[model samples]
Target: MFNKIVLENGLRIVTENIPYVKSVSIGIWIEIGSRFENQSNNGISHFIEHMLFKGTENRTAKQIAESIDSVGGQLNAFTSKEFTCFYAKVLDEHLPLAVDVLADMIFNSKFNEEDIIKEKNVVFEEINMYEDSPEDLVHDLICQTMFDGHPLAYPILGSSSILEKINKKNVLDYYKQYYTPNNTVISIAGNFDTDKTIELIYKYFSNWIPVKKEKDEQCPPMFYRRIMGKTKNTEQLHLCLGMKGVPQGTNEMYHLMVLNNIFGGSMSSRLFQKIREERGLAYSIYSYPSSYKDTGMFTIYVGLNPNYVSTVLQLITEEIDKIKNGGMTSDEIYKSKEQLKGNYILGLESTSSRMSSMGKSELLHGKIYRPKEILEMIDSVQREDVENIAKEVLDFNRLNISFVGDINNNQIESNFKKIIG
Candidate 1:
């Protein structure tokens, strides 16, 4: 069960109490990320995530880390396409300390000029590390190709050139604009008294004033049918195929999940069986859906020998065609639903996972679906739903391709044209 409270300043706090557990997980979710940035400040959200850990007014970076470690607790943060989270896991008795430390960091993080300069170098190295990983780089390429001119295509780790020009003034201005009570949600799970937990949250967060600013209208990204390649000297070609998919918080998302599980989302999935298990064409091949506020993308990725690209692509197309031509069976759908249910239920065993799920749900959709409700939604998915979603999302004509390796651009273009046509 989940309990929620909304502060006078619009800050929302959500919690789930698990009496059997001795630990608690808490997360502060902010609904701002790379999508909120423009071309000039592309990586500022992630940058700010790093700065928050550097130091706070009352605590040095070492003390902040030691404060959690001394109590046998864990603390970390991450930035994604749609949001950012700073979280901690600690014993139930230490919940108040966790809250105080996190609040102090969020409220008093010193964005010193020297720290900014030092962190910029660190970010530059991080970008360099990303550049060296072609497998990871190819996924970013697919996004850049699929959403040709949208902010959704922007890299979460902005380029070195642009990041170099971002100074303290830019960082503070961007942080001030987006880091407000209304745009934030604090989610906690595991053993705690709900009444007392609410009081503790109020102590640290109730005074935060909501920022008055006009919200930016988000434009849905236009999916492009194009091929993009990066020439790199690597042993295997990393390729990604992208197409349109449904947005977040929709029944169609469940339908897509069922379809993905049968198609390429699992080890026993059709793509894995055909390409790797049978033919030995690739070591890694899988498909996933990336859903956002207003739009989404379904992507298929495979790393294979450059010479076998044509064979692997044809096999992938065959599998997609089968799904499009009513090849999925009732058994597959049933098993997938069971797999999803098991995965969801097992994930709840962890306090961190529960905290994350509640935070992301309330922060994005403004509602948290109970376990019973979610299981019912999954069980309600019928054959027609999966089949309809397959036909709608598996349009080869609109496919966009992105690849990285020693393969020639002309070769990739020729293979794509032949297989797709």
Candidate 2:
């Protein structure tokens, strides 16, 4: 069982105590990310995540690193489309030092001008690194094509041109506007005294006052159907086919999970078996569902010789058509349910995973389903539920496509229309 407490200023603290483990994982989750920014400040959320580690009022960057390192602990952070997280893992005895270091970074980071300029260059290099990977670049291309005009399409790592213009004032303003106490959640898991942990959290975070910022109304992104391509000089063509999917915090997500597992999510799935095992057409082929707050995308990816694009796509289309036309068996559904339960249970064995699961759930959905409840939900998904979600998610007319590598866009688009139509 997990415990939750809400401070007077609306800061939420959630914890799970595991008496057997000696280490504890703590996460500070903020409900702000690229989705909250506009064209001018597209990657500010991710940028701030980097800056918070550079230095703070009381500790130099080296000292911050040493604080955790001296204790044999780990510290890191990441930014996503909808949120950002800074986390640390240390032995239970070092929890106080971890909390103090993290709180200092959050509340007193000095986003100096010199650091801003230097980090911009670092982020630019990071973008270059991403561009070098055709497989990874193609996935972002799919989002740009599917979400076209929405902020959700904005890359977490903003483009160099926009990032170059961001100054300390811009960073500070954005940070002040979104990084509020009420907009955050702290989650901890592993061995600890629950009462002592709560008091420790309050000691570090209670006095932090909330900021008043006007709420920005976010309209859900509309899914667009278009073929987007990037001409990269790479050996194999990287491809992504996307369709509409369900949003977060819904029963429909479980249904889609069961459907995805049987379709292409696992090694024994149809896409892997037919494309890689039997025909040996591609080295990699898979599908996944990415859900956001209000909308989601189901993506299928394949990496193969450009010469084999037509054959691979045709095989993928055939699989989709088969599933749409009542090809899935009850046995597949039962097996997928068991697989999901096993994976979920195993993932909980890690304190970091549990902390993340609790933090994201409380920050986004304001509720966390216990393991038994989630397993029951997965078990209860009937064949009809999977079929219904499949029909909704696998609409051929609404599918959007993206590709990267040495291929002619016109030829690939023409082939897609001819085969998928």
Give each model's whole-structure lDDT. Answer: 0.94, 0.93
Work out the TM-score per prediction.
Answer: 0.99, 0.99
Give the runs in model 2 whose Cα sits over 4 Å from its true position.
none
What tens-digit string does per-residue lDDT give for candidate 2 at 19-137? Answer: 99999999999999988888998888999999999999999899999999999999999999999999999999999999999999999999988888888888899999999989889
* Candidate 1 C-alpha lDDT tens digits along 1-421: 6898899899999999999999999999999899888899899999999999899999998999999999999999999989999999999999999999999989999999999999999999999999999989999999889888888889999899999999999999998988999999999999999999999999999989899887789789877689998999999999999999999999999999999999999998999999999999999999999899888999999999999999999999999999999999999999999999999999999999999999999999999989999999999999999999999999987799999999877999899889877
Point out the worst 10-residue segment of candidate 2 by lDDT.
216-225
Model 1 TM-score, all chains together: 0.99
